[model samples]
Target: MHVSALWRHPIKSHGRESIESVELVAGQTMPWDRAWAVTHEATQPSAKDGDWAPCHNFVIGTRTPGLAGLWARLDEGARRVTLRHEALGELTFCPDDAQDQARFLDWIAPLCPANRSRPTGIVSAGARGMTDSAFPSISIMTTASHQAVAAPLGGVLEPERWRGNIWLDGAAPREENDWIGHEVRIGGAVLRVEEPIERCAHTTANPFTGQRDADTLGTLERSFGHQNFGVYARVIEGGTVRVGDKAGRA
Candidate 1:
């Protein structure tokens, strides 16, 4: 199979960006993917040290679906991000700057659920990234599998709801899910597939509209007997992975 698309989320649960390529490191997340995440008031006590914490500790799309509509552009050299949403307009800031963090919080205020703990600030684990998995992982999803789920739902579901790091074409539905413990190669990188990614409520949100328009979890449960949609794996060898590169069990 070949990689049909590549993407990254510079700030966890905040925004997503499309990319042509990225240099991945062994045992590390895709560069700048989920590089920073915001902690809520309730989670600050345990998450303030910039260490890995459970995803629920953060203000995320699962709780605030409106955040899913965000699109982002990154200036890698300058360490600045430009985030845009139909409701919130746009913001460009370096995540490391205190002032910038405040600006981002202010800009995203309208999207956060008022009932949940307020987002206090941003934290970073540097190269480790704050992925949902305790082990640093990259999520790989197939378009065919996406279609398999969408077919019964009118075939209108957007793949963005999955927020996968790499999207492959030419694989049958659920084909990669069987690759657990297998070594796979794409471009110059080698990776080990670890486990299927059991999805959450976040998948129900529409990326373009930022609304929970579908019952993805329920559909997966009824249709597939599980709420899984993608596979998560760790890079075993560091190298450049680019769009359209051949990838599969190696």
Candidate 2:
């Protein structure tokens, strides 16, 4: 199989960015993936900077589906991001800046549900990114498996629904599920496939429209007997992975 696409969510559940290549590090998540997250007014004890926290304490797409509509581009050096949404237009700011965080909360307020926890602030976990899993994980998916799920639902579904980090192009449907406890090599990086990534309400929301238009959880349960769509792997060997790089069991 070969790499097809790569993505990163600089802010947890807030925006997604596509990249042609990325540097993977051992025992760490993809650089800047979920590096920062927007905390809510209801956050208990509050999210402290330079510390990891569970996803529920923040504003996420599951509770506010409209957040899925966001598209983001991150400038790693400057810590700046340009985000766009059909309804909100565009915003450019540095997530680490206090003033910019306020601007971001205001910019995204329209997408967040008033009943849900109101967006309060943004925080970063330093080198330890705040992925849904307690440990750092890189999400891996394949087109064939995506097609398997989409076949029952109709045509090809937008891949962003899964929010995977690395998408492989050639593999049999559900073949990745059998890869647990094994190692997969992509370009120069070697990673151990640890576990299947369970499905969440986030997948039901359309990324472009930010609407709950698909029943991805139902489709997975009915067709695959599990609410899972991809695998979470931890990098064992750090290296560069680029689009079109060959990938296979190591």
Candidate 3:
């Protein structure tokens, strides 16, 4: 198995950005994966509630294939982000304000191209219940795992389908699953493997084009007992990560 790629989503449930390399540090989370998600203003037991706020909350893959096309960059100061997409021109979202949030959502919605009507304003889901249960501030995966799964499915798997915060190269196939309970050193940082990530419908949704293909799910179930193909991890040390950094089990 080998570490082949890395990625992060600046805005939750929107899209992902692939990187040649990255550093994993403890405590410091990656730019996006869970940085933001949409939620309903009124409390409801079901996630399907239509009263939810827009882009500020999490998005579903069933509606927009383009939502997966999101890409972003963190400024040198690591304080702001520049968002981009094929449909929408480049834009930025700062960590400020109600008005700014509204504009951010409006900008994002058009680019997302979701089938459903989206809200104009974006709101936070609060700190609690804001992310997936397996979400760690940072996560990692192996290229071999991608190959193991993709090889069976016509030799191509979009990185966006997995939605991982970090991608690694130069590791054994499916090696991440074996790293559980171990702290893996990545670039100048270290991350502890928490558990194997469980599969979800989100995996079947293509992040780039926002298209859904049932065959993707069938391929996963047939190739791997479970649809899951990655793991969740937490940073144990802090440091900057860039491409070409060495990754290995600590």
Candidate 4:
């Protein structure tokens, strides 16, 4: 198999940015991926301590599907993020600045579901990204598996909905399921497949339209007998991974 794409989400449940290459470090999520998240006003106090916490402490796509429509670009050197939305235009702000955090809150407030708690501030996860799993991981998906899921849905599903960090081609559908406890070489990095990524309500929403137009979880259960689409792997060897690089069992 070969790596077909690489993507990162600078902010949790906000937006995804495509990159040609990235350096993977052992025991860490992708650089700037979910580095920051918007904390809701009613979030638990433990979440405000700037440490890793469950995704429920922040505004996420599952709760507010409109977040899927937002896009982002991160300027690591400048410590700034520029967010774009069709209705909100573009806004750039430094996540560390208090004022800028409030500005970001204001911009996204309208996008929040009316029934949900509103965003109060942006929270950082420090060196570790705010991933869904408690342990740091990289999400991996295969083109054949995606097509298999799409086949039952009667439509082409967008890879963005899976929000996978690595997309591979030339693998059989569901082949990665058997990769657990085994090392896989992706580009120059080596990773051990840890577990399957269970499908969630977030995948039901369209990344472009933010509408719940697909029953992805249902389709997975009916077609695959399980609610899973991707695998989460922990980096074992650190190196730069580029698009088009070969991927195979290490």
**Prediction RMSDs, each to the true structure:** 0.9, 1.0, 4.8, 1.0
List, residue by residue over 1-250, the lDDT tens digit for candidate 4. 9999999999899899999999999989988899998899788999988889999999899899888777789999998999888778899999989999989888888789889988888888876899998899999999999999888888688878999999999999999998988999999999999999987898988887778888899999998789988999999899999999999999
Candidate 3 residue 42 Cα shift, in angstroms, is 5.3
lDDT of candidate 1?
A: 0.91
> Whole-model lDDT, candidate 4?
0.90
Clashes of each: 0, 0, 28, 0
lDDT of each: 0.91, 0.91, 0.61, 0.90
Off by over 4 Å in 2: none
lDDT (C-alpha) at residue 17 in model 3 = 61
**Per-residue accuracy of model 2 over 59-149 as CA lDDT, tens digit each:** 8888999988999999989999899999999999998999999998889988978688799888887777888888889999999999999
Query: Which segments of candidate 4 are over 4 A away from where they belong?
Result: none
lDDT value for model 3? 0.61
Candidate 1: list runs displaced more than 4 Å.
none
TM-score of 1: 0.98
- Kindly provide the TM-score of model 4 when superposed on the true structure, using C-alpha atoms: 0.97
Clashing pairs in 2: none
| TM-score, every prediction | 0.98, 0.98, 0.75, 0.97
Pick by lDDT: 1 or 3, better one: 1
Per-residue lDDT of candidate 3, residues 133-183 (tens digit): 534445677777777777877787776677776677777778888888998
